[model samples]
Target: MLHDAKLPKTLWGECIRHAVWLKNRTLTKVLQGKTPYEVAFKRKPNLANVPDWGAKVFVSKKSKSKLLVHARIGRWVGFNDDVEDFEVSKGHRIYWEDSRSVTVERTVVFRKDEGKVRGFIEVEEEGVEVGIEGEGSVNNPNNPANAHISNSPTSPETPRSESLEPV
Candidate 1:
């Protein structure tokens, strides 16, 4: 939103600062004497291929899980801001389950000259019936594996209606 709202890109700056601080205060002192750059370099060299913070990511599918083939690509948002999640561009087909986070890429298909476009997704209207076993819903039911939770369930334990709290 900060990007789309045309707001100054300061949000990303604060995010970077927080990340540097968090690195120093991790649960373990694994990098006790080493600097972040040193530790990162030790782990892997030639970080040239590293993409932009919010560029885009498309994690390939594995044997144990189903893939949202149509949504194979997703924007590379920042480290998650609200939750422990890394930041990601807000849009459809973004959801995390268990320890796995999966998001489909968001793209606006537009014809430059004619200004005609279509939103494309990996979902299939006619073909393989891909079903995922999880507690979530797909934005486009045609693409089942792209998971999302519609809303919290209202149970007898919690009131269905919300009452305003004193401000």
Candidate 2:
């Protein structure tokens, strides 16, 4: 599934780790409808800790430097059952580069939108194609093609600006 997803080879280890974690909890007819986790531990595995594999997430960092931000932008890649922590990617550069940015940390924030990308959602408000303004104002009704369009500040459509603000 990792290869089919077009994920890089360096991520294969992480993907395999996640797959193994999931496989242990899956039921099989050969096991008399018992999961490997249940058979080995004599208890049902906790599924609550499991998260979406490729979802965007942020990892919290513990540092002494004031310049360091509280969190690092990353993606959830794997889980380490030994330490009860998640393996998150600081960036894709860690795949090929010498950077050892991948870390196991319990403090992680997953995107609220689930399967969709964070910051922006394509909502066809009143059938208007809300997009970059070409010439006239994006919301100008003079062009029937442009209907009641709004990238409302109150809405999640403009989450990027809100996130950049000093916390």
Candidate 3:
């Protein structure tokens, strides 16, 4: 699904792990009509916490200001293992000065109809050249390589290569 959604390679493992976890908790033939989670815990798995991975989500505003924005837009990343909260990340960081951190929040609203939020941006490693081969590569405007391929308004006749070559 990650490849189909045009997500970056870096996210493949995370996506796969989440998928596997869900599959384990869901009914499957391998479990002999019982879900692995149910068999292990002697109870049905609570799937309500599961949200669409990479989906656009709105986290409830926790600020005390009267002019509250109501919610902050973020991308649903995964479930928090130690809590009931869902893990979410704000694209482009919360601010230039703030460290990029995933916020675990219980109040989340998924925007399923708006399409999956595969808004992950790739930050180019220092000294790595970005751009098509032999094009005097520079740092991509969309960050490492073309992170906006899936979000681009125009679709190319041929799928563009995503591999990066060292400068």
Candidate with top TM-score is: 2
Model 2 earns a TM-score of: 0.54
Which sequence of candidate numbers ranks them by lDDT, best first?
2, 3, 1
Candidate 1 per-residue lDDT, tens place, 64-119, comes to 54643533433343333353433244332322222335344344221222211223
For 12-89, candidate 3 gives per-residue lDDT tens digits of: 665776687788788989888999878987888887645666666777777889786888776665665543432233
- lDDT values, one for every candidate: 0.40, 0.61, 0.58
Q: Assess every candidate by TM-score.
A: 0.24, 0.54, 0.48
Off by over 4 Å in 1: 1-14, 17-36, 39-45, 61-70, 78-167
Q: Which residue window of length 10 is worst by lDDT in model 3? A: 89-98
Which number leads on lDDT? 2
Clashes of each: 10, 0, 0
Residue-level lDDT for 42 in candidate 1: 55
Task: Estimate candidate 3's alpha-carbon lDDT, on a 0 to 1 scale.
Answer: 0.58
